[model samples]
Every structure is written in structure tokens, then in C-alpha cells.
Target: MKNYPQAARILVAIDCIIFGFDGKEIKLLLIKRNFEPEKGKWSLMGGFVNEDEDLSDGAARILYNLTGLKNIYVEQLETFGKARRDPGERTVSVVFSALIKIDAHDSEAVRSHNASWIALDARPKLIFDHEEMVARAIEHLKYNAALHPIGFELLPERFTIPQLQKLYEAIYNIPIDRRNFSRKLLSTGLLIDTGDKNNNGATKKATLYKLDTEKYKANFHSFWNFMPDSMKE
Candidate 1:
């Protein structure tokens, strides 16, 4: 085997920014570090990559260790390789963004790792470069939510248009016009009226709707202008 004569030996790490929407607010899953180099501080669920594992597999393993769920919606957000990013070692971190249904995750798995879900806007100070990774994840969420149907990943199996609207509002931190919002979403033809109603809201019960599973899976990547102009860059 041939090796590069002057190749730098740097460690590789994978950190996940897990986002969830609980009907009304967007939240993040964070862990209270249990080891040195910032033990007890809020941090992302992360670990060093194993020598024989692939990048995505390593990310999935880290997420599973913290959430006890598999086959989740995960993507590589960015790679942070700042020389001094890790105070304890010279490591290049690959950040992943995962969207999950908050209620479906295993609470015991999170508890085992000293992890908790924090409202996105109310999160505490994070360790190392975790905060920056979270900010980038938020930007990615907002950007993709505007152009794709990815927001539905954070919602329940069945929900009303108002509930979906609130999810988007929470993601962008802005209120959407009710009338246009409903019309636009309906026009997508991705929602199937479930003949049910949401009896949980303070106001009158709203009709329940579920995704058109066939259409959703087929058109998940198509462009959809769901964000309000004010929220756009």
C-alpha cells in the first residue's frame, strides 16, 4: 500500500443536530456531556468515527445511540475542519441534521445519555462549535422548508392544515397568512382529507388531513414555495 508522505493525521468526528416539531414549537435534542473537555455542559450528540465505518453509518450509529430509532431522515449538513475547533484534539467534524417526530423517539434512550429536548429559541449555551453547527442546521431547515416538503418530517402521521402552518411558522419564526397558507398547501395535492378533526385546539375543531403518501413520496423533492416573502433572503 502506498501512503502520502506528508499527510496530516487528524481525527474525524460526527455531530448531529436533531430537530423536532411538537405541533406548535420547534425543538432541538441536546445532551449534557458526561465526559471531560466540557463535561456537564450542553452539547450535541456526537462521537469519533470508527476506522471501519462509513460516514453516514457513523452518523446513524451516533443518532441511534441517543434516540434509539433507525432509518430516520438524516443528511450531512456541513464539514467543520477548523484547526483549533476541538480544544482537546485536532479533529474535523462532519455535522448531520436529523428531523424526527418528537413523540416517537425513545425517551429512555435519551435519558440514558443525559439528553433533553430544548425549544429551539430557548436553548442554553452549547459546548465547543455545537452552537454554530445548530445555527447552520436551522438555516438549512428554513431554506429547505421553503423549497421542499421536508417540514412534514417533523409532523405527526395525521395533522390539520393549521397544525402544519404552525410548524412552518415555528421553523421560520414568523406567522403566515391563514388564507393563503391553506390555499397554497391544498394546491400542492399532497394532503388527503382524513374526514377527521382536530379536537385539541382552543378554537373550533379543524378538519384533519394526512399526507397523500404516494404523492408525498413522489414529489418530496419538487420545489414548493411555502415560505412567506418576509422570511426569504
Candidate 2:
């Protein structure tokens, strides 16, 4: 076996910033660092990419290992390649942001890894460049959720308009006008009346609706300012 004489050793890694909505606030799935260099501290779920695995496959493997959910909204956000980013090695990392429904993931898997869903705003200082990665992912979410309906990935299949509004408000950190949000959302023709209602122990029962799959696919990338003017206030 022959190797390049002057080539330096470098390791590839994947870091996934998992986001979820528990119907009230948006949160991030982070793990307690289990190995030293920074053991026992909070960190993003990450792992070294296997020699034979592609980058995307490595990311999916890491996500599945932590959440036990697949085919969700996963997007590659950026790459961090600072020479000494990893105190232990010369590693370059690819960052991914995943949006998952909080109730759908495997809690046992989450616990096995010492992971917790901490509120996005309340997450503690992360180990390394991960804090920057999450901040970038947050901006990415705001930018895309305003133009697309990807936020639905953080919601249940059947939800009320108010539930949807809460998801957006969590994402944008803004209070949306009830009538305005409902009017804008309904006019898009993306939701289908399921003829079911959820009161959730409330005095008023709200109608449950699901996405019109066809319309959702058609408009997934189309621009619609779901971010209303109320956000400016």
C-alpha cells in the first residue's frame, strides 16, 4: 500500500442539530458528552464518519442512532473545518439540521445516549463550534419556514390551526395574530378538514386538519410569507 508522502491526517465527522416541537416550544436534542476532551458536558449528537460510509449516510446513521426516526426533514447546513476545531484531532465536520416531531421519536433510544430535548432558547453552552452550527440552523429554520411549510415536520399529522400558529411562533419567537394567521394559512389551501376536533381539556374544541399532500408538495418550495406583519411588532 502506497500513501502520499506529504499528506496530513484528517478525520471526517458529522454533527446533527436535531430540532423538535412539543406543541408549546421548539427544542433541540443534545447529548451529554460521554467521552473526554469534554466529557460530562452538553454537546450536539455527533460521531466520526466511518471509512466506508458517505457523508449523508454517516449523518443518517447518527440521527437514527439518537432518535430512531427516519425520512424526516434533514438538511445539510454547513461544514466547519477549522484546523484545530477538535482538540483531540484534526477533524472536519459536516453539520445537519433535522426537524422531528417530539412525540414520534424513540424515547428509549434518546435515554440510552443520555440525550435530552432542551428548549432551544434554554440550551446550555455547547462543546465546540456546535453553538455556531445551531445558531446557523436557527436562522435557516426562520428563513425556510417563512417560505415553506417544513415546520410541519415538527408537528403531528393532525393539528389545529392554533397548533400550527404556535409552532411558527416558537420558530420565529414572535406572537402571531390569531385571525390573521388563520386567514393566511387557510387561504393557502394546504390544509384539509379531517372532520375531527381536539379540545385537549380546553373549553373550546378546535378543528383538526391535515396537509393536502398534493398542495404541500407543490408549494413546499414556493414563497409564501407565513411570517406575518405581526412579526415586526
Tens digits of per-residue lDDT for model 2, 1-233? 15787888898899999999988899999999888889999999999999899998889999999999988889888999998899998999999999998889999999999999999889999997999999999999998988888878888998988889888998988788889999989988999999988868331489999989898887788887788786555
Best by TM-score: 2
Q: Give me the runs in candidate 2 sitting further than 4 Å from their true place.
A: 1-3, 201-204
lDDT by residue (1-233, candidate 1, tens digit) is 14786887899999999999877789999999888898889999999999999999999999888888899899998999989998998999999999999988999999999999999889999988888999999989989999998888888888888888888889888878889999989999998988887887642489888888799889888988987766655
- The Cα local distance difference test for each model comes to 0.89, 0.89
* lDDT at position 228, candidate 2: 70
List of clashing residue pairs for candidate 1: none
